[model samples]
Target: MSVGVRRVAKGVGDFVIEALGEAVGEFVLSLLACALLGCLVLVAYLAWSFSPRLTIAGAGVLGLLLAHGAWQTFRTSTKGRRRGLATLTAAAFGATAITAIFLLLYGTGCDCW
Candidate 1:
């Protein structure tokens, strides 16, 4: 291929990659999701070990996450189905966390919401 053609191809490739990365949030979303999940795990541990009071806090945070997931899942103007899928996944995780919190509370004879 001609050098000019190669240059154009390389430039197009670079532009497309950068555009997609910025539009899709590259790895930023992944990092935030993983961090949130890690925190949930830590909180669950703390609630189980230190005190059941932390379970109340976990329930509140998980409820927020669940609501966000529901909101995203119901959005109509997103560019792609990935957004809905991610939110649905988040909703599942939130429900699981909430269940865990309830179980801990039950074990403690609290049954707190």
Candidate 2:
């Protein structure tokens, strides 16, 4: 094979390897994020189901904060990466947080006597 052809072949191989590396990295990151989100959701559910009114409020606030952080992370992720999946997960979490906040408000019934 010609030297030019050999160089091109090696370049293609290197590009493939780099792309695979990026894919693996993104996969791992997404998995970790999902695992963490699951744990948070579990804890939030427990709090919402069993806690006192004041404690439920605290948990609601915490969930909202975490969701906001996830949204920011999603938005700041660069293009051509796993940003789309991460953004979707963030949206799910954001919606959950908003729902929880709404439930909290509804349960508390903000009224001045």
Candidate 3:
């Protein structure tokens, strides 16, 4: 190949590599953010739903969410295999986090509207 063609090919290859690296970095960051959100949600739910008599069901749900968040963190760190499971866990965590946040914000307050 001509020198100019070789240089162009090399530039394109570098661009593709950099883009892939950025994408992977963004994915990992997103996963971490989701995990944090899940943790926050679990905490909020436990706090909000706590009663003077201590409800067992509320505690159980909090435990489940906490365990799921931990499991997702494990799967995400071991990224060599089980990509499908990791993705599902991350998505679930994000959805649960959003739900919990909304519930905490709106479920208790009535006159804030």
lDDT of 1 by residue, 1-113 (tens): 99999999999999999999886773454454555556767878877788677777777876777766766656674576555556675667667667566545433332222
Over the stretch 8-113, how does candidate 2's per-residue lDDT look in tens digits?
9999999999999999976665555555556766886787778679677786775676666576655655554555555565666777667557445442342311
**What tens digits encode model 3's per-residue C-alpha lDDT throughout 74-110?**
5546445546655566566777667767555544432
Clash totals in order: 0, 0, 0
How much lDDT does candidate 3 score?
0.65
Q: Once superposed on the true structure, which residue ranges of model 2 sit more than 4 Å away at CA?
A: 60-113
TM-score of each: 0.34, 0.49, 0.43
What are the clashing pairs of model 2?
A: none
Native-to-model Cα distance after best TM-score fit, residue 16 in candidate 3, in Å: 0.3
lDDT against true structure, model 1:
0.66
